[model samples]
Target chain A: MLVGYLGPLGTYSHAAALQQYPEEELKPYGTLEAVVEGVKNSEVELAVLPVENSTNGEVRAALDALIAEIGECPEIKAVGEVRVRIAHQLFSRSSNVSQVERIYSHPQVWGQASHWLSSTLPGAKCIDCDSTSQAIERAWEDKNGAAIAGSAAGSVYGIKPLIANVSDRDENTTRFLVLAKQPAPENKQHTMVTFCAAQQDLCKTLEALVSSGVQVTFLTSRPLGTHWTYRYIVEFAGALASEQVREALAKLNQVTPVTVIGAY
Target chain B: MLVGYLGPLGTYSHAAALQQYPEEELKPYGTLEAVVEGVKNSEVELAVLPVENSTNGEVRAALDALIAEIGECPEIKAVGEVRVRIAHQLFSRSSNVSQVERIYSHPQVWGQASHWLSSTLPGAKCIDCDSTSQAIERAWEDKNGAAIAGSAAGSVYGIKPLIANVSDRDENTTRFLVLAKQPAPENKQHTMVTFCAAQQDLCKTLEALVSSGVQVTFLTSRPLGTHWTYRYIVEFAGALASEQVREALAKLNQVTPVTVIGAY
Candidate 1:
């Protein structure tokens, strides 16, 4: 089977993909849209994308990709999820931290390491790259540059960490979801749905789900893109096949557009 | 009065600050954390920061800044809000679009203009800069580069728009909140609150607010940073001084840790 993920290589998404399909040929896509497109175009059997992080909020690019692809590929659904502990390490070609004049990493990585960066290398310039591994690649090529990436990136790029476990928070983690063209099994444990409810009707919609005893595992709002209001993505504990979930979704549909992204 | 906002002028935050406090001397800070620090240190009486966008969801940097400042400045509260329409223009030192070989922009601006960029400048390299105005400054100094920024930046940086309204969406808007040491006036119309609730307790918390007829106006979640769960920020339609809102919050506090960011 072919599995797709966002990468240069050695990204957290790559790690998650490996955990999900250890033996499969993993293909790296430059962007989330490209990964979704891969599944939509039958270029890959499954795609894994980061949904949220313990230290960062929802991954907007992945969520936005789903919002944009809703009409184009109605069959896409989340099949399963994997949680990975995130540990950012400072990798460098130079053995000494003082020799590093610039640091390269994804912008989000900069946030996770900002506290350490200011105290350790206050004068260093931070250059944002497309991905952590890409940052590692650039830093590897530069004489006076270092990068913040996972140990996997360090190993893949032939760079060594000057310091390890540099992330500010100890409990940092990322939740990734697997997407495919098939619906989840009927016996799945969780269901994820994306819906468009107007700002005025938000409370009523929440009431519908809560009143049904549908344990809302996660709830987040994204911009509707065409207006100033928001569209919500909710993950609930029961499958769509459950009677309670069906009734709740039916009531929610009375107020706004609803789509079952998948059950897992 | 002095107002602090994200700097090097001509940014949407600058526009929002100008619209809200036209008479105040606008102090430009290099980062959102710096702006918040200015307010905490009384270097500025009020600080304006972007919270969310109609096209993008929440501004993570602003949210993270608030999270970091929560313990240090418990007195900080949101005083008011300002909405600014974001119209990204392709500004260039060159006379034609074809002459532009590279594009410079803040990462968020790249999202708003990605569709246009892929079609118009398929071969151009996108370089992320610190801010939109900073991107314009760099582009202005480069012979074959263009930047994506507002008209204010174009005017301020002595560059002209090669094409206007280059944003992919028509109704791109950003919502910004004003922060200050003083609490919002008791008569303010809306109240905002941030709370920490375990993922399992989310439904119960929402049910409590809904059952109380609290009319949740807005809701967004952020990572708790220290744990694998989330901290949610909710904006509702009633002031904290109102008996109904007070009772509702009291009930919510029974389930989770809650803080009233402010009423405005």
Candidate 2:
């Protein structure tokens, strides 16, 4: 299947998409809109986007696109939840880290790396870019400049890493979601549901679910940007075969339009 | 009151803080944690953080810290709200935009500028950094580099703007939350709430709130990184002062610990 994602290459979305599908089958798009359109037009079989990061928050374009899709949009079926292992390295084309006068990477990295960078390279500054590879691309032109990105980015932009995994925590990972016209089969172990809540009551929601017997596997919530509205992604187990699951869903339909994002 | 925020200067947060406080009373913290700690230690009378962006997503660190503080610590209190006008600019030491070989900015700026950057500076490499001021600081050390950041960041980092308002959209603005140890005098206009729900059945929880007459103002849900589950920030109208609101919250609290983050 053809997989579409946002890239100039070397973005985590590209890495996660490749991890889920055949690398050779990867098709990169410049925008989240284009990626979604690819699936809608059948230009590609599936699209992958960063749904949320452990530290970053929700990718609004992805969420906005979700609402924009509405009914005629693809049935966002199976979610290939890929947890990207982030290792933001200080990269360059030259010899040592001491020679670096400037570093570059995504702003999220810069925000996360502030304490270490301000201490480690007191004089050197960090530049922000769209992707880690872009940092490498920028560094290729300057001898004193370095880039903070992943090791995978090194190959794409023809550079070497000055240091590896400069992030604060080693357990840094961003979870990605796969959007397609078709979701996976109901026999899948993991299922994802996205819905908007009128209130921020997690307890009552859980009560209703547990009262019906749906074992939650994982869950994440993000804002809908309209003051105090939210959308949630919940991963639950016990297959769609369980009568309790069906009955619980019927009960939920009474509350809101709970879209089955995926079952994997 | 002296307010602190992440800056070399001229980040949206800086502007947002100024909009809220005015009178140029911001302390300009280098890191978000520094800002949080500043508020905690009373280094600044108050601090501001960009909670959500219209086109972008949560300024992750701020959200993480806020949730962690409200849910885990409860030492800090949400006090005020401000709207920041985000004006993306292409900045450089050189006055000519055509001579610019590279561009820099925070990843959020680059994400918002992808289309414009791709079309405007196709050959120029875009890199991400900690903030707009940081990007301007990096570009100042290089002659060929241009940075995309805020107009105010220019004066703060000693750089100049080549073009103003380079974001993909013009209506972009980020809403920041002002935090303090003391709560603001009670206002019924803005109310913030934090709640945790069952990993499954968020719909049911939300239904209880809506059915109870809580008109949501803003909502985004994402993982809190505690127990691998999720928590949400919901903005609603009217304070818990109203009997109906208190009753809804009381009933909602039966299912979850629905705490009032703040109402201003």
Candidate 3:
């Protein structure tokens, strides 16, 4: 099977794809939308896209792609999920961290390692790159520059880790969703649902789900392309194949338009 | 009165501050945290901070600052809000848009104007700067570069707008909150609350709010600096002075530990 991921090629997404499908053929796409499109166009059997990070909250681009695809293309669905531990390392050609004048990284990396960077490199100027790999490349070319990326990416670029695990929080993990043309087999452990409803109706819908004894694990609301209107993406601890989940979803459908993204 | 905002003089936050308090003396801070700190430290009578953008959803850094301040400092509160219409213009020192080989912007602007950039300047490389004003300065220095910023920013830098209103959505407006040491007058129209609760209790709390006929306007969940646990930030359309809102909040307090961020 061919799996697509956002990469070039040392992103946490690349790490996730490798962790989820060690033996499978993996292809790197330039953008999250492209990775999702690969699965939608059937160019790849599966695609790994990061949905949320423990430190950074939701991965907006990835979540937006998932919401757009699942909402517009009925066949495209999230089939599974993989959680990857993210350990960002400072890579530089120079041996001394004190000599680094500037650091390059993806914007997300800057947010996660902000505290560490502020304390350690108070004078270093931070620059944003399109990807961590691109940052590493920039760092390699600049004598006084460093980049934040995974250890895997540093090895790929022949750069040494000046500092390891620079994230503000120790347990920084990212959750990536596997997307496919069809939903996963019904034997999975969790079900993810997306729905749109008015504010009052949304409250009632949650009440109905809770009353039915559904354990909702994660929930987030995104604007539904208009001011003040929102659509919610929810993940719960039960498979769609289970009767309790089905009944809960049925109740939710009655109150609001609900889309079961997948069970996994 | 004095106001603080995130700026190097010409950011959307500056526009928001001007829109909200044209008569006040406005001071610019380097980051969102600094703007919030100005209010907490009584350095500024009020601080205008962007909370959410219609096109880009919530401003994460601003939201994070609000969450941290309101959670830690009881005196810090969001007192009022101002909505500013955002119109992103491609400003360049050169007269021709096609000659622009690179585009500079804050990371959020890239997300907001992505579609316009990809279609209009397909060949241009995007470079992220700390702020839109910084992007404008970079564009002024780079012979073949353009920056996405408000037309006001363009005027300040003496750069002309090569193309105007590049945001993906036509109704691109950002909601800015006025943060102060004390809550707004209770006669205002809305109340905002933040609370951390277990997943099940969260649903119950929402149900409780709904039962009292409170209208929820905005709701978002952020990770509580941990793996799976989350804290919810909610805005409702009733002032704390109103009987219905007070009753609803009383019930909410019974269910979870609720912090009334403020009323406005």
**lDDT on C-alpha atoms for all candidate structures:** 0.85, 0.71, 0.84
Instruction: Report lDDT (Cα) of residue B101, candidate 2.
Output: 87
Error of 2 at B199 (Å): 0.6
TM-scores for chain A over all candidates:
0.95, 0.83, 0.96
Q: Cα miss at A36, model 1 (Å)?
A: 1.4
Question: Model 1: runs farther than 4 Å from truth?
Answer: A158-160
* A1-264 per-residue lDDT for model 1 (tens digits): 999999878998898888879999999999989988898888999999888887777788798886577568888777888888889999888999999999999877876777889999999999988899988888989989999999878878776688998897887788888888887655677888888776788888988888888888788888777665788888888877888788888888887778888777
Ranking by DockQ: 1, 3, 2
- If you assessed candidate 1 against the hidden native complex, which CAPRI class would it receive? medium
Over A147-205, each residue of candidate 3 has an lDDT whose tens digit, in order, gives 99987687667767888778888898888888999955577889988888666566667
lDDT of 3 by residue, B139-195 (tens): 889999989999768777776788877988888888988888985568889898888
